[model samples]
Target: MKSLRTLRQAAAIVPIAMGRGKGRSRQALAERLGPLRGASTKVAQLLSARDGEDAGRALEPLPLARLLPVMRAAAPTLLGDGATIGAQGRRASLGQVHRAELSDGRDAAVKVLLPGVESDLRSDLGLMGWVGRRAGRRLRQRFDGVAVDDWIAALGDELLAELDYRAEAEAQGRYGRAVSSLPHAVVPAVIVAGDEVLISTWEGGSALADAVAWEPDKRAQLGEALTGAILHPMLTDGLVHGDLHPGNVAFREDRGGEIVLYDFGATREISLPARQAWRALLRGEVPAWDALLTLGFDAERLAPLRDRLDALAALLFAPFRERNATQIDGAERRARADALLGEHRMVPRLAAPTSAIPMIRTLSGLFTILGHLAAPMELWRVFDGADAPAPALPTRAPGKHVAPALPARLLVRSFGEDGRGVEIRLPFETLPDLEDLLPDSAREPIERSGVDLGALAREAFARGPIPQTLFDDVVEGRRVELRVIEA
Candidate 1:
């Protein structure tokens, strides 16, 4: 009986329905054959899993035959020439991509929504919200924190938006227009119908990992350009590429060594304050908790939370800072990052959680890629010196907004008598220029007099093993620090 049912359902999905029987329901038969619905349900469950072990398990790939029929049915005109399907790469619950040659002799990629994904996502998002709320309540009980209901609500909203390809098309168009003038950055065109189907010009290049493996220098240059493109819009324009992942970025050799960016389904508009926070990070300036309060963060509420952020950042950057004397090997850096990620899989639940997760993941992935390619830390200097060009806002007054001015002096201080170092301190204003501090060469510089201490620290600190003697303190809003340890 089961075998007969399976065969009947498969036949219905094919070019022709083969078997006919009395009292058989087409809807029930179709459901049996349509893996899309099953797969989407599974994906939603995985995504909503409270723990990584439950979430990271992979799902089975759906057959192309089932999807092709749906695509052809929706856009007969586009696929009238009998679409020749190529390789199907990397199947996730959301969708799968195919590399194909269009009948018109153009190389393109087609993305098809998995069967029942839309409906499954809707159900899954609701479940996740419930789980998130429950989790938040538990945390609040244990830690005396408020439930992150707003955050969960924001995530639910974004997830729903992502399920709609039509909305994504509009977003992609907006981003394309914004970065249109920029060189070496590409956003693919989308083709939409009743069911959202996207057709984009195929971007061919080595995966970033492979590119870095082939030529380290080229990887470094690419990393710089990619970082500039990713960060500039966020800091200067208040627009962020919400979904930046290794899979989303492609490297093309022909376009003057360009990095092609794809998938605008998760794009987001950042607030001005968040943009400023990002800029501060790029400049290596850690603003005070009070400053964040001024920008609308609840200081009393976030003071303890800020400590955790500091700890996480320190943990993340420790290798770069403490091991300054040693070379940051790309493979080793990735391994370390993976280990760190493994140690803590749960991200801070915040409003717009989806946006936050992707951005955080992207930052980590980009930095890891850079480290793997041996890209000089100096490449990050672009954000520090000579302000980056901000994205023009259609509504905002021109020239009314300017970047916050850099502080005049940066100071570093060290604490402890002579041998046992207690702490290192740095004043906010005294943060050294990020570009100048990054090591261009593997060799360390020798100490000399009449040299700017900040420059000396930049070179000396580039090599690993931060000295215990160095410490930093702030004075009159200027950056001040004392060094107890030498790297």
Candidate 2:
């Protein structure tokens, strides 16, 4: 039975089993749960799907034939008794998408979650979350200065949200309003929806990635459209389309070929100040230090490293500086990336303002679309509003002292004999007391010398309020296998 307790139990066991060397236990449990509705079957389905492998070999996709029955039973109950199925098609993801047309001739796309998918996803995410935390901890150990949990949790949230069409409808509305000013862009309008079923106006366009074979000028136009539709929104408005991989975007040559954007599930928005700081930083200026400080940096940590932060900022933004539009070959970009990573290991904390995590994902996702098109556009030029030409890298040495970017959530997950011993969650706003972030079990070891918690926070955080260093030590300082999760 699908009870709250069952879901919670799955959530509890999965990560704990993963944290310990209980891979066998996790795998066995996943297997045992296979017969249950929406059980662990989806774990391998998503994995293989993303990897571009034979995903059906891992988990069978519901063929168009089988989709109708599931849709038939669920649609009337979900949409209404008057709803009728008009059209059906296979969505790119592992489910059938049906067009529900009413007697009134209104049409919409309805996606019903495959049987047992929600439960399967929960288990998969729990185990996958453990792996992500482990990876984050390992990366931290190497001083790579990245938090894996932040991205992973964001990812989990996005995937789960996709199951709810109502959320997607709201996001589509938000995106439509956000980019309403862009010339010749189309965002589908959502008509109505239940938890799993969405009814919206159908959208049609050529896949943006499919346009790679188009003429250079046409592809370039599409690239610019992609930028206006996807990139500029983040910089100017902070609202963003998080999943911009090739398939999610398209172009239409029919009506003057407007860039068509869809799949509004994985959406994110950055703060205004963070966006402003990014613009300043990309323009080869000192990123708005005040904005950076507002993000939560202590003056003490920032004072010693401002110049280096700028230097590192220069290196990170180097790739975007080349605005030739067509001059960059893949090899050269790779070389520059390698050189920067080799000569100076730029800290991740210094790369962007902390609140820009969504922006960070959006920017990286843009390049991924570019790589698919092999149509790398002059993104940097957009910032300068220039036409003559731009340099390959910053004309000056880089400098910027970035305090460790504060996490959205601070999680101290216990890795005791229970594996799921206990956790302390400190949202950024409530982190007034560093001691409060730890379990009673952790305070004794942390306050060993009666070190002033606030002073240590000021020294380590030098930004706003998190002493992630102290938190990191609490998780890592122990020789045991404790895991620290950055919220």
Candidate 3:
């Protein structure tokens, strides 16, 4: 249900902040946002994994018309004197992309941040950290691993970088230079940049949405191109376009399919060892227990989830495996992942390898894109042809699965601590503000069915010491530092 406070807040901004364009009215899109919940942290970090994207897998652009005033105010800063806004424009995540007629006559897309968005972002991240850290602290009493506060702070920083336009321009420039070999992808050219504004040559071609209607081969080509663009940069150059959802990529048919990436604000850089680990994993070499530790696992806490390691490895890399999946293809994969995770049975753990977070985040986003594109193909083939030597990864024997306890024992020795040696009846509290997590869609169904949906949601998410199995899926996610605390 829309809160009275929220509805009033919407009334104040919708007219002032939304603008209609040639296509969708910006106000309509805002309404679609469903009760302007405290600034849409749903922006999901471009570099970020939503507040719970890693934990539970979790918006729209503001209008361009009403936004022109702010755009004009920042215009001279980005496009120079006499440069004014053009009528036709659209929205990008967290900002509006306006058509700008520069003083020099170059047409560009000018991006401007809405005032106060930064505060809202901080608030959302704070809430997430408060909740996640509490859960993390409990896990730590029994499990050793990534400090939830640190991971939250790192992610918060990554998301915060998107608010700075200048940082984006730098990332854009570097990415454009790095992808010279990815013939199918187009990285935007930075025209002029400012702390709050970014001006770039506008890109055109059908969006990935439009291409969904195209032939499967065309879609497959697009999927392949995008995967290569993302992988090449991260694996070879250590830079990655952290956001690659269908909305962020555009497709044009000059040859098979040319993919264009927009919104560089959320770029993430990967470390070399992390890249090598990914290469090794792809060849079926699950990293040694130590490698997993470096990648972000808390050994003592992670011991119980040993079998799920294969599931975690597969989840981190898929969206391509399984007969080359497309948007429509993840159910089988998700089911497989769910089975491996056994989220309901396993104690919750969040053991993310510190260095590999970006790659994990990218994969999370990539899996979502493949689900949207719904195009299937053999993803392993994409890497096999590369010069990166294919090390013969140790594969598991037919049906027998076993835990690497020796390595776990060794890891504990190396670290010299056994997590929490004593149990003091660690207390847990209910999830703060369970009301905040409710989905708008639930209300209508409740009204129609006379069901107590709010009660149901609260029942499931009511906070306290989070169940060890409560967020096991997130624990398995490479982006989150996780561990299993056997009760």
Q: Please, what is the TM-score per model?
A: 0.57, 0.60, 0.64
lDDT of 2 by residue, 315-410 (tens): 555545556634444446557656555533434443332334455556655655555556546656455432222222222122323223323354
Residues 63-98, model 1: lDDT tens digits: 777788766676676665856767455454466667
Candidate 3 yields a Cα-based lDDT of 0.54
What's the alpha carbon RMSD for model 3? 14.4
* Residue-level lDDT tens digits of model 3 in 1-487: 3345445544443443333242433333334442233334343223232111221012344656566666656665455577767655554445667777788877788877765667665555554544455445545565443344335545655666788888889999989887877778888798878777788887767755567688887777777887787777766777878755555667886666798888888787766655665666654455544345544445545666666776666564654344543333556666766677674333323555333456666776776665566766566655654436534333222211222332221111122122211111111232233234323332243335455534533543443232221211111112211121212
**Model 2 CA lDDT for position 114:** 67
The regions of model 2 sitting more than 4 angstroms off are 1-88, 91-96, 99-102, 133-140, 144-146, 149-151, 287-326, 343-355, 375-487
User: Where does the lowest 10-residue lDDT sum fall in candidate 2?
Assistant: 387-396
* Stretches > 4 Å off in candidate 1: 1-60, 87-90, 126-138, 144-146, 191-194, 253-256, 284-291, 294-296, 305-365, 371-374, 384-487
Summed backbone clashes in each candidate are 49, 26, 29
Best by lDDT: 3
Q: Give the local distance difference test score of model 1.
A: 0.47
